[model samples]
Target: MNLVFLYGPPAAGKYTIGRELASLTGLALFHNHLVVDSVAAVFPFGTPAFRRLREQFWMDVFEAACAEDRSLIFTFQPEGSVAPDFADRVRQMVTKAGGTILFVYLTLSHEEQVQRVANADRGKFGKLRSVDLLQSLQADFEACERAMPPPDLTIDTGTTEPSESAHRICALMRDHGLAR
Candidate 1:
């Protein structure tokens, strides 16, 4: 099993690139919002129920995928202070299951992130759509990045096309001998 963990601030094109990566690599896509939106549908965000259910659901999916030796691409937001250990635990789980994890960080200029927040497509996934909220989140993500270990690969979506970014990520996986 192989897990491609792609993370970045809102509007950093994580999902866009993940989709392309999955299409190219045949890895399953498990973007963050799938669980977020589902859990939010029942429990409110940040509530105890939401947190517990979200964590449990994520764990179950990951464990199942690892056990099945499935390769996957997962997109996430940088969770520096809020959930610093989350990614580490996931990595441990994957390695324990004899799987490889590749961390990819996607980013772009803050100005572009802010501008992209209001795109109609974002709302389709219940994504953050406010410029102010995006700015705040990006600051937090920056701090998180400084505290976290560097990713296996980093792409600037503002300069690179999504397809190109995906290709770079796929290349990294191939170089690591995790993909064909």
Candidate 2:
């Protein structure tokens, strides 16, 4: 179970780095937006119904991934500090995949987050929301910071290039003996 969880503020390149990480390790990428987009397509954004369905779906998928031997890299921006056993299910997943879990978090300045949100003209996910630049990105980052397992790797994405960050993540994964 090569499970690597990538979390960060919007446009902090969680998805991009997660991709590279997955590519390096041959893990599957289950990005945050995939769930949002699938649910939103049927129920549109901001609907309570959509939220329930999406959350439920993700839980099941996570569990199933754990049951099956699959290397997975998923993204999440939780609402607050993670539970003490936050990595339990993920660890199970990685074990199933014949590997271990790695937790990677990306941090950035509020100003950088706001700037990116404003310039995030390319994302379908961003265009759907009405949150002001700072609030939206900051809230998610705050949540992830609070809720995640102690990160195995944390990078200042604001100061680093995406590829560089990804490379460092790979190094962390290797150094931590997470590679199968």
Best-matching candidate per TM-score: 1
Candidate 1 lDDT by residue in tens digits, 22-54: 999888999899999999999988788888888
Per-residue lDDT of 108 in model 2? 82
Stretches > 4 Å off in candidate 2: 44-47, 80-99, 126-133, 136-144
- Model 2: per-residue Cα lDDT at residue 150: 78
Task: Please report, as a residue range, the 10-residue window in candidate 1 with the lowest summed lDDT.
Answer: 77-86
lDDT of 2: 0.70
Candidate 1 TM-score versus the reference: 0.94
> Can you give the TM-score per candidate against the true fold?
0.94, 0.78
Candidate 1 colliding pairs: none
Candidates' lDDT values, in order?
Answer: 0.87, 0.70
Q: Residue 174's C-alpha lDDT in candidate 1?
A: 93
Error of 2 at 51 (Å): 2.8
Judged by lDDT against the true structure, how good is candidate 1? 0.87
Question: Model 2 over residues 98-154: C-alpha lDDT tens digits?
Answer: 667777888888677666666555365543232474574565557546655678888
